[model samples]
Target: MARLGPLLGALVKIRWRTLLGRGSAEITGEVLMLLAAGLMAERFLQYLPEFPVVWVWVGLAVCWLGMSRGPEGVPGQFPLTRGDRMVVRTVELAVNPLSWILVFVTGRISGWGLCLILLAGVEWPTWRRGKRVSARPSRWPALLRKDLRAAVRLFDTALAGVIVLMFVAYAVREANLAVEAAWIVPVVVALSNSTIALNAFGTDNGTGFDRYLLLPLTGREILWSKTVSLVVLVGGQLGLVALAASWRLGWEMGLVVGVEGLSLLFLLAGWGAWVSVWVPFALKAYRFADGGSVWAGLVAFALCLGPGMAAARGDWWVRLLVLWVAGAGCWVMLGVAGRRLERGRERIRERLP
Candidate 1:
């Protein structure tokens, strides 16, 4: 038992570094997750009625999602001794997001907590592996399906956006506080996604952008495909979040958040097309972003940050105005990106090839 403490601490440190290495945007997303967890914990303690089933599942969800979502290297690359396994499991349980819920519930219902702990304790690799794969082709084909597949290439980034959306929903639900700053969520999402959004061409290990060239689409058409992909990525997460928030926060908040998210999506998709043409790079999952041009960062700020900051003090209607203006910009930018993509086809091939 005494020897196990040191081993557990060492593995925990390794896990932390691996997570931190994913770069600032990714880290910020994680920190926000903890914050959302903490906020919801307060809400749960105060208002929600207790059901044993609810308590058990909520507790189990904390560690299960953590173990699944967080990358922990290739399974069994290095042997884990008995003590090593014990330590690794302990640390994973300890640092999981929304961990406060698990602790408080355990104190209230020790039996359920123990069972949940035992269930989550067993070895399970990353979450994506546990996902149930679809058997049939999608009913929706063409660009929608294409976009959906591209978004899956780095679904972790989309999950980060989900965290942001959930956090914003809960934050607004807090009593005696204002929800005037809905744009913050979309802004954070845009910046967090900069790793991919900035380099749209490199979504799937330098291969995601290849499918576009296969089609006889023009540059505007190519950019439109990527934009649809972004829409699916952001929109799907937002939908799930709104459903969850609707359960606790009112449905009104969901509508408000939808407006906010759509506003930013227009700006993001429009400007992201330009970034893809002018400042593209390849993306690798679960690692620090290696390459991006200055234009990428500047475009993100000008497109997302500017509108977000302007609407900080106003309510959802202000964001709607920003949405209308961004829609116009999106139209114009799409044209510009298409023209550039058409002219620079060979050059883009040289760089991306």
Candidate 2:
């Protein structure tokens, strides 16, 4: 226990070296995060002049949250312990003058403020526990499994979890009241991921796209792999939202929304196949951008989102018929896009790495 201070200091130095090695990939997002925190802190300090005691407690809570992230390592990975909690945020705690100012301000805190010091700065050891993963890949299709893994690495699950929480809160607040707002869920999902689906091959670069061409599968099969993966990934988000709808609206409403959302996903995926062939662009690793061709993107959105928009106004039975029609039309679109894909293989390759 006497060596704890030295251990923390050593860990911070080690973390700095690790940051210098792999920070480039994460620096963009992390810097933006710091800027936002700085802005909030500036406003907080301005307010502190009037109600110094109240804001001091708030500052302590903020610091505690900054340190209280999930276990340092992922599930099924190596573990990081109490002494190893050093991260970029920990670096900020030491190096940032604002942190010390908060500390200095906190020292002036007399009664309850002093009690919080033990809770705020002291690292709790139990927080290091992580879930054990039962990773059974054979249960999932190859393409879907790959896409799911990519989604996890990209933190898409975090975004979906946040959206699901929002829906849950809305449902709980309107516990007895029900509305025909299920259609809005699909609309939000589509708009959020429209450009991502359209540029499906962009992240792969030439090497990954070439690997697809080299496979024994036909062009249509390659398109199927890409398109189906997008549906499965995006559909997971829709499924969670629909489950929340069931709790608030009713099971019947949940079924209607799920079916409607699946139809929208199919139509959008078909449109995405065409866009992938027409306006494919290479992307730097670990980044996202608009699909590069605004005209193509707008056209895709217009064609694909109609079913979802119409679902809001139509009857449930009418939507069932529309789903069948959509699935058929999407199949046809995919077939044509696959043919064009083969013809434009060289052109697509030129746009990638």
Candidate 3:
């Protein structure tokens, strides 16, 4: 136990440094976001009186588990010779029983049992195959396809999509909530999309970082490809939100929100590209760093959402003006980020570890 104490402490410190870097503001913002999410979850539960709270808890747990990027190469850097497989399995075994307890306590054993069965059915084949698979050379189509697949596979990405839908549904059910939906929907979508953009290179998990350099594509091409992929991926989700919002808030309001959502996405993607080059960090499954791009996103969201909501109040010219300005700004930022990415490729490579 004495020896394990220091080992655990070392592990925590390493994770903190890797994910959060030295940003106090980032850390604080993440904590506040977490508290806000908890409050929102409580309110969400209140809205669903018929549903079991346990299901929400279970869903949250699953989403949290899915958010994990899994054990990356950092664990390999440690003196521990056992490898990450053992470490990961040990942690899983320790926490999995808690899931079972939640299921049993809720008296939804059968439902939870089926969920476990379905999960096993989906995961078993992948686990059985246990082989290292390499990606094909980076072409735009292939890269986009890969990013889309990765996005779908991630629990948080899917959760974000669901949350957007939930917000839309809530707006549809509660007319009074429409005002909140305008800015809320766009902010949520922007932050969701920014996850990949800001942590662009981190997705390589240290293994593929070097292979990117070897690829035939230029840095600008690589950056643009990722940007386009994320825009499409998150844009599709935003479209659904728009449809739902439109159903409740009317076409004009929906159109305005939709335009604002897309604009926020573009702004975030551009900002993400710049940060990816200038302040890259390794991706982790769970950490405060997950909210790394959020502070900037919130600032942009405020700037865009205020004028957007006002314009939505009934000013066609204002809406058009805001869209044009935001769109132009997005393009300028993208151009600047691409140039920075090209110039800083060497530094980015050096930082990846």
Model 2 misplaced stretches (Cα beyond 4 Å): 1-140, 152-161, 176-180, 283-286
lDDT preference between candidates 1 and 2, better one: 2
Report the alpha-carbon TM-score of model 2 versus the true structure.
Answer: 0.61
- The prediction achieving the highest lDDT against the true structure is 3
Writing each residue's lDDT as its tens digit, candidate 3 over 151-213 gives: 655544655665665565466556565466565666666665566667677666656667777
Candidate 1 Cα errors over 4 Å, as ranges: 1-159, 165-173, 238-257, 288-290, 314-321, 349-353
Model 3, residue pairs in steric clash: 68-285, 69-285
Q: Order of all candidates by TM-score, from best down to worst?
A: 3, 2, 1
Q: For residues 1-353, write the lDDT of model 2, one tens digit per residue.
A: 34445555654565455446445635565455445434434432442343543444444334433332323433114344544444433543465333454555555554456535533443343343464755566533765666555443332233333444444544655555345446665665665566556777766778878877897877788888877788777787788777877777779777877887788787778777878888887543322242267787677667556666566677867787778777887788788888988989999999998
Model 3 CA lDDT for position 324: 69
- Which predicted model would earn the best TM-score? 3
User: Residue 155: error of model 2 in Å?
Assistant: 7.1
- Model 1's alpha-carbon lDDT is 0.59
Query: Over the full model, what C-alpha lDDT does candidate 2 score relative to the true structure?
Result: 0.60
Q: How much lDDT does each candidate structure score?
A: 0.59, 0.60, 0.61
Q: After superposition, how far is residue 78 of candidate 3 from its true place, in Å?
A: 19
lDDT, candidate 3, equals 0.61
